[model samples]
Target: MHGPGSSGWLLVTLCAATGAYCLLRMRSSVEEQRRAAAGEALMGFGMAAMAVPTAVFTPPAWAWPLWAAVFGAAGVHGLWAARASARHLHHVVGAGAMVYMAVVMAAGPRAAHHSTTAGIPALTAALLLYFTAYVLVTGARLVPVPAVAGGPGSTGPRTGPGAGWGDRPELARACRLSMGIAMVAMLLTM
Candidate 1:
C-alpha cells in the first residue's frame, strides 16, 4: 500500500477500471451470454482485488488463504472444462497463477527477503514471462487474417447479438489484455 500518487495506486486504479468494465458488460449481456462470460467477470474482479492498494484496505487475516483455495479450485475446474477446447486453458493458467500469488502472499517473507539469484522474485518472473507470451499470442490471433476465398468459408464478419465489439469473445480478450498489463505493472512494482 502506498499514497495516491504512488504506483500501487495506479495499479489499483487500472484494475478497478477494468473490473468495472467487465461487470458492466456482464450486466448488459443476456442469460446465455452471461453464462459464457462468467470466467471473464471473475478474472476482472480477481485482478482488481489482487491489485488493490493496501493502504486503502487491508485484507483480513484469512483473505489470502481463502482466495488461494477459491482460485485453486477454479483452476482445477478449468482443467476439466478445457477438455474439448484449448480456449479455456488460459482460464486454468490464470486461475493457477492467482492461487500461486495468493499462497505466496499468505506465507512468503515478502518484506524481509529478496531473490538470491535474480533481482526479480521467481514467481513474478515466471508469471511475467507467461503473461507476456499469452498477450502476444492472443493479440496475434485477434488480428484480422484473410481466409481462403470461397474455400468452405462463409460470407464476411458476423453481425448479431454475439458479434463484433462488446461481444463475449471481444470482452474476454479485453479482460485478458488488461490482466496481462496489470501483471506486468505488478511485477515492476515488486
Candidate 2:
C-alpha cells in the first residue's frame, strides 16, 4: 500500500548513491568523452530531481519554477535526441520518457507516482526500464580495468583520466546493480 506521509528519502537515497557511482565512473575512467559527459550530466540531474510529490513532503509551490527548469532540461534533451545524427537508442528513448514525466510533474493536476490511474507509474516505470538497460549494456562492455598507473600488468584504457580497476570496473557494475535495485523500487512505489 503506497500511502501518504512516507518521506521520499528512500528514492532520494538510491538516486544519490547511484548518481555518485556514475559520476565517479565518469571522472575516473570513462574513455569515451561523449559518454562521460552525458553520464555525469544525467547523474546530477537524475539524482537531484528524484524526490517530489509526496503528501507531507510536497514541495513548496515556489518549486514550480524549479520543476519548470527540470521540464525545460528534459524537454531539450528530448529535442536534441530527436535531431541527433547518430544516436544511441537508449538515450533517445530515456530522454523522451523523462520529457513526459517532467511535463506531468510540472503541470500536475495532482498525479501520484503509484496512483491507480497508472499513467504516472507507467512513465516512471519506463524511465526505470531505460536506465536499467543502460546499466546492463555499459556494465557488460566495460573493458579490463587496471590496478595502479604503471603496475606490472596494466590492463586499462590509456586514454581515460586514470588507469585503475578499483574505481572504473566496479563503478560500472555498481551502477548496474544499484540501478536495477532502483528499478525494483520504482515499480513497487509506482
Candidate 3:
C-alpha cells in the first residue's frame, strides 16, 4: 500500500485536495460548519501524510507514535463534539481508524508489510464495513431530489444569488463521500 508508485501519488493528491477543500469550507458563516470543516481538514491532511509511499520516504521511528497521538487527540475531540451534533460521531470513527493504522505501522516494517497478520482481522473488518456503509449512504444522499412546482416547501428557485462555494451543502456532501471512499481504499490496502 505504501509502495512508491503512481497509485500512491494519486492517493496523496486526492487526500491533499480534499483537505484543501475542507479548509475552504472553514470559511463558512455557520459556526457549526466551520467547526466540522476544521475537523475534516485535519483528517484529510493527516490521511494524505499517512498515505505517503514508504518506499520513497519511510518516516522516522518517532513519527508513527506522533501520528497516533495526534489522531487520538482528534478522536477525543470528536467524541466531545458529538455531544452537540451526531455528525461529529463520524469524525470520531475516522480518528480512531487513523490511530489504529498508525499503531499498526509503528509495530515495525515487518508488521507494516504483513498487514493481514499484523492487525486484528476482526477490527479491520469492522472498520472496513463501517466505511463501506458510510460511502454507500453518503452516495445515495447525493442524488438530487426533484422539486415540485408551487409546492408548499418550494422557495421558487432561491431568490438572489446562490450560496458561496464554501456554504454549498451538496459540495460538502461530495467532499465527505470522497473521503469515505478514500478511507475504504486505505483500509483495503491494509
Q: Pick the candidate with the highest lDDT.
A: 3
Clash pairs, candidate 3, are: none
Global lDDT of each model?
0.69, 0.52, 0.85
**lDDT tens digits, residues 102-183, model 2?**
4555555466444447554655666666666665766565655457766865654434445654344455555555555554
Sort the candidates on lDDT, descending order.
3, 1, 2
RMSD of each: 3.7, 6.4, 2.6
Which candidate, 2 or 3, would have the higher lDDT against the true structure?
3
Q: Which candidate is the best by TM-score?
A: 3
lDDT of 3 at 118: 46
RMSD in angstroms between candidate 2 and the native structure over all alpha carbons: 6.4
| Model 3 Cα lDDT, one tens digit per residue, 48-158 | 998888778889989989999999999999999888888889999999999988998899756645635545466778999999999999999989777787876467433
Evaluated at residue 152, the lDDT of candidate 3 is: 68
> Which of 1 and 2 is the better model by lDDT?
1
What TM-scores do the predictions have? 0.75, 0.54, 0.90
Candidate 1 lands at a TM-score of 0.75
Tens-digit per-residue lDDT, 1-190, candidate 1: 1224366667767777776666666654465445435665676677678777776677777988998988888888788878867777878888887786777667744741456487776877787788888778877766766778885444765578656355656556766687777766655554
